[model samples]
Target: MGTLRDLQFALQLKIEELRQRDTLIDELELELDTKDELIRRLQEELDRYRTTVSLPGPSVVSAAASAQIEDKQRAARQTVISEPFIPDAATLAMGSHKSCDKNQKSSRLIKAAFLKNDLLNLNEEEVRAIAACMYHTTINQGCFVLQEGSIGDRAYVLEEGRLDVTKDGQKMRSVEPGDMFGELALLYDCTQTYSVSAQTDSKLWVIDRKSYQTVLMQCGLSHQAHSVELLRGLSFLQSMPEDVIMKLSDHMKECNYTDGSYIIRQGDTGDTFYIISKGQVTVTEKKPGREESIVLSELCERQWFGEKALWGDDIRTVNVIAVGEVTCLIIDRETFKDIIDGLVSDSCEEVQKSNASKIKPDEDPFLVSSTLSDFQIIDTLEVGEFGHIDLVQLKSNIKHIFAMRVLAKKLILHNSQREHIRREGRILMEAYSPFIVRLYKVFWDVEHLYFLTEACLGGDLSDLLKDKGNLDEYCTRFYTACVVEALAFLHCRGVVYRDVKPENVILDEHGYAKLIGSRCMKKVEVGKRTWTFCGTVGYMAPEIILNKGHSISADLWSLGVFVFELLSGGLPFDDCDQMKIPTTTIHGIDRIEFPEIISKDACALIHTLCRSNPLERLGSSRNGAKDIQKHEWFEGFNWDRLCNKTIPPPVIPKVQYPLESSACALYGEGSVKQCMNWDDF
Candidate 1:
């Protein structure tokens, strides 16, 4: 019975233990369920935040905007924190350009440190403006305080520095505190002669000359000696209107002189007169002084030199070699006279009138340094032949108009037509006929030779034809007469002008014609004749195509074609296909046609000029001018007036051309011919 009872107790205990284990497992499951629910709620919150905060795709937010948003988020987060701190206005006052009012000691000290005793008189605004003008500059030891030979723009007052002054490499003196220097270049009418060097690391108050002058004027300090010095430096004395020198005369101390120094150098003339200012100075003899040595003389402070030079005599009479170092108040001539007359001189002292057009200087530093080293470039103007030509203005406004056959530099060295073009220019100059184009001068510059002459100014006949389309009877007669005169002169001179075309004929301002380029200067072999046909394609005669040498008469035939082009607006016989084909090249001079509208007399003149045989061509005689004079078409015209008349220029070039941009492209005589034709042989 005892054993059974023990077993029942054990079973009861085991069952109770199993019930406790089931309870623990139920608690564990409940905790796990609670943790899963919390995690899901947090994930939902995060997803909602991401929808508002995160950017879509690769879209970027700017840093500034992002910072602002982040600040807003931080503010929101701080509000949730429930504690915030705000600073008072007093905190903002601690950082700024303003000083504290309560700190009167510090404020007063700062004000006093900046404003000297003299500045105490100025109001706050005036003080600030004046202070703005004053700049503090630091200089290293041994560095230049002010350099000699440099334009003086600024003057300095030393605050904490020592400086040494040297004149022309000689030591003058050293200065301590409150010493001022370098008012000379600014206050005197002279180039700088002294250099100031810093003896120690220094601080200085610098003011520009203009500001300094303003300060002096405001102070009413004309009675001071520096006023005279200031007046001497100014260029436009007549503009001054007030004579400050008389008030400052007593302060103008005289300077002394010694040997071996110049009192006044010969040929170094200026307007300023000097009191002998003590000591002896030697006057230089003419011959030796000009080439070598100087002479001497003795004078006093009341005595003066170079007074005559100031009164219109520009040449210095003597070279005064000082027996010693010279010192003088040395007022400028205008300033002295203005002070004496109690009036300001109205004369500009700095710049002198330059003689650029009339003459070139023997030693022109500007030209030596300038890039235009070749043919002297003068100006471009509307001229004959080319429509626009360059006029090379020589010494004394003597002008030359040139038709540069070539402008490109490369062709000058390698092109074959250089000799012919040069010869043509020379021949034209030699002819000196009023009808022919004249050459004035020739020179090589920038790798190209320039042929300068008077510009025709009325533009070329080609331009006229292009502009007018067709010529009137009066225009036709006028142009024809001028050309015939030119051709007659060329023929008499034994010159054959081959390139006769509208472009080769230019009109003067009065509508008279002038012949331009010539192709008759080609080198002819002895008895072998140069038959390389050259002329305007439409204007060439039939004989030019037969490999026959052209004579001066060929030009007359060409002139007839030119007149035809002028009157009819187009070539009489223009078959482009025929002109291009070698077999069909024009070989008949008589093929030229006349318009139905042409007058009989004009037609007769054209026939004579355009004859198929060179012998029959007008102006073909040995006395071609006489023949042209006898033409019936020129009956009423005054031959003398027509030949000798000077037409007023069309346009006077009035421009101060900028140097670099004005240089024309130098296409030499050779380069120009490269584009022209000389293919027929």
Candidate 2:
């Protein structure tokens, strides 16, 4: 009976222990279930992240729609704490919507900045109009916004991220949000002075030049009229009527001068006239035999100077220095002349109407006082195939020198040739370049066409080459650079100068190269080829020789030959017999041998330029003259000084004033014929 009782107690104990084990197992199962639920939630979150990362940003929305998107984004952000932070489909949509809203806000900021920009001087309505015209663009990091020396067709206002600005490989500064760039393009056609690249993903508001200019014209008419009124307030310009003043205002450019800066030196040639808008300037005259400059006068605000320089005298008689920081409205010589011409024409018309006897009806009232009457021929400079050039001087109070080219109609055999000569005159009259001869006037008599051009007394390159058998590298580079610039300017204007030889390049008194001989020049559209069998034999490119369509590439080829001849003192393909020259040139540079004296870079440049295929030529590249200018041979060359005629030439020609017969004979033989009266055209 006692053993049975003990066994029953042990059974009860075992049952209790089993019951406790069952409870512990149930707890473990519950924990596993919770963990599985958490893992499922984590996987869902990961999937959402992948979706968000892969999805594209929202497209641009209208302003009204953007407001609704912003509200949804706000609501989505508010619900973040209440729900899982994972960006699910709803959250992803809100994120994209937020980006669209951000863009809208950025655009608004850009518009605000434009409104506040002092340079633009825009009114509220004008700002709104310009803002409406602006288009938004986003640039990726490490991408360029503007490149230096590139045509700046659009202005940009940064609304997000930063940009790095550089000039000539040197860091200039950083452009941050709210800053504007390429604004000058809005005012006129200009090249970007600095390169701007994105440092981060950036958003910008861009306004193209055409749109900007349109807005400016619409909004700035009153401002322009105000400027005209300001000009009319000045004593010197007081004589100008409202119409003339309005015309003058269009051509004026505002410039600033710092304290102690020289505006114009006494000896420098002046091509600009200035009217002080602010500050003062001191006009000092150089006292003869004295080191100290004498202060002639002081000009203050509303006063003007440099008027005398525009009367074709050119030379600045006084040194004008800024007394303090000064602002001036300046007009260039070309614009000033145009204004004067208009005024003269109006005056002449009025006078003729009032007194018919003073001006004949058949006579051209514009030519009443002929340019010929102002000039007195001193001596003949050259006798060419169809024309003669003479040294002439202005008989006016201010003596100015010029070279008058006379083309005899009888000498030109073909009517086309006569038209070409006329075209040359027109080209000379219209072309205003430092590298080309400046034409003052063009008129024709019954027998001859007259071209009164700026005299270049230093003679031609052929003479220089003859006197000094071979030129040094520096000399060759200088002259070649000038020609390159001249060609670039002509090419830009669609003019192809088929002839670019040493004989055609005339050196001025300053030893700057002036391109002449426009007979072979033809205006062709860019990328279009001409098939004229023209130009000198040895200098001609293969395409020209074979009568294959040729363009500006021919000029570049001639430039190579010119450089070779200049450096080597002999033509690259010159043969004893003249006929063999064509065959040699047509065969390409295989027969050509470079001298030991020629640098490797120069030889390379020549090879590239003289390639059998015109397309492979150096300057023929899309960059055009810039490619040639940036060549290795031209490395370290001061192109600015070359263009400005500031670089000292290797050889300065020994030219005398009022040249004698011997000096004149250097070009060729010609006579100054007084065939027509001064009044008769």
Top TM-score hit: 2
What digit string (tens of lDDT, one per residue) describes model 1 on residues 1-681? 235644554465356446646745764564555455345434544554555666545435576687698665333212010011111234222221222232344333333433442212233433333344555556667767665654455556676769888978898898665555553322222234578888986766665544433332232222233445444454543354332433223224455566576667667757766654345556665674366664455564444566675456766777776766665655555544534443222122112112212232243333233221234434444222212345433222223223332232333223234545555765654656566666544444444444545456666776677667878766776776777777765554446677776766776545567887563443332111233345544566655543233456667877777777777777664654322321222434345456776677767767787776665677654335566667786677666666766532232223233233233333233422111121210
lDDT of each: 0.50, 0.68
Candidate 1 Cα lDDT to native: 0.50
lDDT digits (tens) for residues 1-681 of candidate 2:
325644554465356446646755764564565455345435544554554555434553576587697665333212000101122345333322322223557657767787665444455656665676677667667767777765555788898889999989899899988888776555433446688988987777888755554454444443455567667876766777665775577557778999999999998988898888889999999978999999999999878888876677788888999998998988888767767566767566457534642332243233335455555656667655456677776554224567888666654532135545554565555566688887666656565667777788898887788778888899999999989998887775667787787877998887789898576676765434555456666787776554334677788888999899888877887666443566688778756778998889989989888988776688764356889999999999999888777889877777677532221211222333332333232
Report clash pairs, candidate 2. Answer: none
At residue 321, candidate 2 shows an lDDT of 98
Q: Which runs in model 2 stand beyond 4 Å of their true positions?
A: 1-370, 414-416, 659-681
> Among all windows of ten consecutive residues in candidate 2, which has the lowest summed lDDT?
77-86
The Cα error of candidate 1 at residue 291, in Å, is 99
Report the CA-based lDDT of candidate 2 relative to the real structure.
0.68
Residue-level error in angstroms, candidate 1, position 593: 4.4
In terms of lDDT, the best-performing candidate is 2
